[model samples]
Target: MFGPEGPSLRELAVQALSSVEHGYDLLAPKFDRTPFRTPGAVLDAVAGALAPAGPFGDGLDLCCGTGAGTELLTGLCHRSVTGVDFSAGMLEVARRRVRPAGGPGVAWVRGDARALPFTAAFDLVVSFGAFGHFLPGELPGLFRQVRSVLRPGGRFAFPVFAPPRPARAAFWTLLGFDAAMRVRNALWRPPFVMYYRTFRLGEVLGGLRDAGFGVELYPLPEFGWRADGSPRARLVAARRLTPRPAA
Candidate 1:
C-alpha cells in the first residue's frame, strides 16, 4: 500500500512497462513514499544488532537504491560508507537524500553488483529490499562479488522476514504478485526479475556458503514472534572465510 505521496496507479503502470533502470529512475523521487523503501524499524533493528559486531572501519551498501541502508551504515561504520547501484537515477536520488552529515564519510558509485569494483576494501556490507531484483541463479555471483569487496572477517548482512503462511491473506497476495511477475517476464523484454517467493532461506544459505561465507541467522527480537514461537524476522550475517593458498 502506498501513501498519498506515493506513485499513482498510472505512474506505476508506466514504471512496470519500462526497463528496471528506467522504471526505478521514474520512481526514485517518491521511492521512500512507497512500501518499496526499507522501513525505519527494520533499519534500527539491524543497526542495533550490528553495533556489537562492529565499530567497523568502512561499510558498503550493495544495490543501495536510494541509500536507506547507507544511512544506517553511517552509524555503524567508523571510517567511510559507500552506496553502489547500477541505476544512475537511483544513485542521483540517493546522493541527494544522503548528504554527508552525521558521521562516516559517504560516496556513491554507479556499477553492477555482479562485478564489484573493489577487493577486500570494506569491513561491512549491507543491503535491503533489493534481493527480489536478482534471480535465484544470480545469487552465487552476487554473493561472491560482495565477498570480494569485504575484508577478512567482514560481514555481509541483511534482514529477512518470515514468509507468510498459506492460510494468511498476505500469502495469497504475494503468491499472486509473484505469479503475475513471472507471466510478465515471460511475455516481456529485458525481464524484470522481482519475485518475493523466489528467495528461499535454504537456497540462500547454501548460496552464501558456496560463495565462501560462514553464515548465521540472528533473530530480531524487536518484532516478537509468531504463534509457533518462530522469529518474525531475522538478520542473516555472512562472514567471508579467510582464503587458503594453493598447495
Candidate 2:
C-alpha cells in the first residue's frame, strides 16, 4: 500500500534483508509516504484522549521515528518535547520535520530505547508503531527504560488496536506475516524483529505492572467498536509509581 514516493519492491526487498536499524535508516526518508507511518487520524484521536489527562509539562517520544507522535506532544505538553530514536537517519529527518515554527520546543536525540539516558526527566512519554521492532523478551527492559525517564506519577502512553479474530482475513494475513518473519530471522543476521501478532494486550499489561506502572486503558472512540461490543482501539496509560528507597 505504498505510494509513488514510497519504496519500490526491489528497495523493500533490500531493506528486508538488512538489519532492523539499517533497514529503517534506508527507509527513513520515505517512511511517511508509506502506510507504515502511524496515521494522522490516530494521532489526533490520541491527542484528544491525552488532553484531559494532561497539561503535561515536559514530554518524551520513545522511538519517535520521523516524529509523528512528537506532534501530539506539542499540543499536550507545555514546556518541551524530545524525540529519541536509535537511528541517526531517522533522527535527522525528525529534526528537520519538527523544527520550531512557534510550536512547543523540540529536540531529537539518538540513542537506544532500552537504555534511555534520562532519569525522572519527563512528565509524559508516548510511542507509536515501534513495538513490533522489540521482541517479547525485551519488553521488561523497554518498559523499565520508559519508566526510568518519567517523573513520579508521570505516564507512558500509546494506542493499541484490538487483535483480529481467527475468522477474519486480517488475522490470517498477520499470522502468515509473523510466521514468515520467524523463518526469515532464523535464516538471517542482525534479525529484523517485527511481528504483528506478538504484542498481545494481556502480556503487555503484565509487563507494565512488572515495570512499576499502575496501568489503565481508555477507549478511543474514533475507531468505534467491534461486533462483539469491545472497543476496537484503546490508549494504554501506564503511570510510573514513585521509587522505593533501599531498606
Candidate 3:
C-alpha cells in the first residue's frame, strides 16, 4: 500500500487479475494516492513546456485516468477539454475529483484508445502513465487512432522518462516486474498488460512516423540529465503532418 488513502495489497491483487479496464475501475478511487498516478512534477513541467508552444483550441486526454493529465490539458487548451477512458469508474472519480476553474470546460468519455470515437476533433492530444497498458504491437493502431482524432497539424504529446541504467537498482527492479507480468499473463485470463521495457524510444518514434507524425523531443529540465548528457526525462511532441485519407 502507498498510504492510508491508497489501495491495500489485497485490493491491488484483485485489480491486477481483472482486465485493464476493470482493473483501473477498481483502482480509480485511490489511484492518486498510488505511485501509478503521474506526478505533479511531470505534469507541471509538461504544462510549462507546452504553454509557450500552444494555445490549442480543443484538447483530448487519451486514456485519461482520474483526470490527472486531463487537468493539465485544461490549462493548455482554449476551448473544451475531454478525457476518454474505457473505465466508467475511473471517469466517475475524475469528474468528482478534478475541478479546474476558469479554463476550458471539461467532459469525460468512456471509450477505448485503440479505436477512439472522435474524428479530427482535437487540436491537441495528450496522455500520461497509460502507454505500458498497450502492447508494442498495439502502438501503430493506437498512434493511428490518435492521429485520426487530431486535426491536421495538430500535436499529440506525452512525457517519457529515461529508462533507468542497467547499473542501477531501479533497472533490475523493473526487469523483475516485467518478467513477473509475463508469467502472470501466461497463467491468467484477461491478462493485465503492463510491461515497462516494451515501449522503447526508437520503436515509438518509428510508430509515430508511420502514423504520419513529425516527432520532436523536448527535455524536461526538472529531472536534469544522465552522464552521457541525455535528458533524464523528455516530452514527446508528435505533430500530425497532414490529414489521413477519409476512411
Candidate 4:
C-alpha cells in the first residue's frame, strides 16, 4: 500500500500471488499512484542525462508499465514513440492516462519483452523498473531483443542505482524481500519472478557485451556519490554500432 489512492494490502497480496502479466493487469489502474511507478525526479534526470544524445528518431519504451518512461521518451525522440508491455490492463491505463506533450505521436503495443515485434526500427530504447522481473539466465536473450529492435548506432539506456551496503537497513530490507519472493514462488504457480539482487552490474555489462553493445556508464549526479567516491547512481548507455546475432 503506497498511499490513499494506491492498492490496498489485500489487492497487493492478490497481485503478488498472480501471474506477472495478470498481476499487473489487476494493479494497473492504481500503478502510478504506487511507489512501484518510476518517480518523476528519476524520469527528469534520465531525460536530462540523455538530452545530448538525442533529437533521436522513433523510440521504444520497453516494458513501459503505466507509461512513465514513455512520457520521458516524448521529450527526447523526434518522430514517434511506442510503449510495449505484455499487460493489456496496464496498456489500457497508459492509453487513457499518459499523453505526449509535444514531440512524436504515441503508440502502445501489447507484447512480451523477450520477443519484441519490431525490427531495427527504434533509434532509442529505454526501460524502467522491469529488469527485476527477468531471471539472471534471461539476460543474454533480453539484451539481444533490445539490440534487435535498435537501429544502427542506436542506444538502449536505463539508470541503475548502486545497491545499499550490508551495513545499511536498505540492504536487509531488499534481502528480506527477495527471500520472501523466492519462498512465495516455490509454493505458488505461475511465479511472480521479481528479485532485487539478481541483476548485478558486472553480469549485466557482460551480457550487454555478449549481445554486441558497446556499453558506457554516465554518472547521474542527481543522486550524488557513495562514501567510497563511486557514483551513487549511473546511467547505463549501451549502443548498438553493428550487426549482431539474435542470441
Candidate 2 C-alpha lDDT tens digits along 17-135: 99988998999999889989999999999999999987999999999999999978998888999999998888888888876567578888889998987878999999999999998
| lDDT of candidates 1 onward, in order | 0.92, 0.92, 0.93, 0.93
Estimated TM-score for each candidate: 0.97, 0.96, 0.96, 0.97
Residue-level error in angstroms, candidate 3, position 29: 1.1
* Tens digits of per-residue lDDT for model 4, 1-247: 4889899999999999999999999999899899888888889899999999888999999999989899888889889999999999999999998786677999999999999999999999999999999999998999999999999899999999999999999999999999999999999998999899999999999999899899999999998999999999899999997865799
Query: What would the TM-score be for candidate 4 when compared with the true structure?
Result: 0.97
Q: Listing every candidate in turn, what is its Cα RMSD in Å to the true structure after a full C-alpha superposition? A: 1.2, 1.4, 2.1, 2.3
- Cα-based lDDT at residue 58, candidate 3: 97
Candidate 1 has its poorest 10 consecutive residues by lDDT at 96-105
lDDT of 1 by residue, 119-238 (tens): 789999999998999988889999988988999999999999999999999999999999998899889887777899989999999999999999999999999999999999999999
Candidate 3 residue lDDT tens string, 1-247: 3988789999999998999988988998888899998889999999998998889999999999899889989889989999999999999999998798788999999999988989899999999988999998899999999999989999999999999989999999999999999999999998999999999999999999998999999999999999999999999999999755899
What clash count does candidate 2 reach? Answer: 0
Which residue pairs in candidate 2 have backbone atoms (N, alpha carbon, C) closer than 3 angstroms, thus clashing? none
Worst 10 residues of 2 by lDDT: 95-104
Name the best candidate (by lDDT). Answer: 4
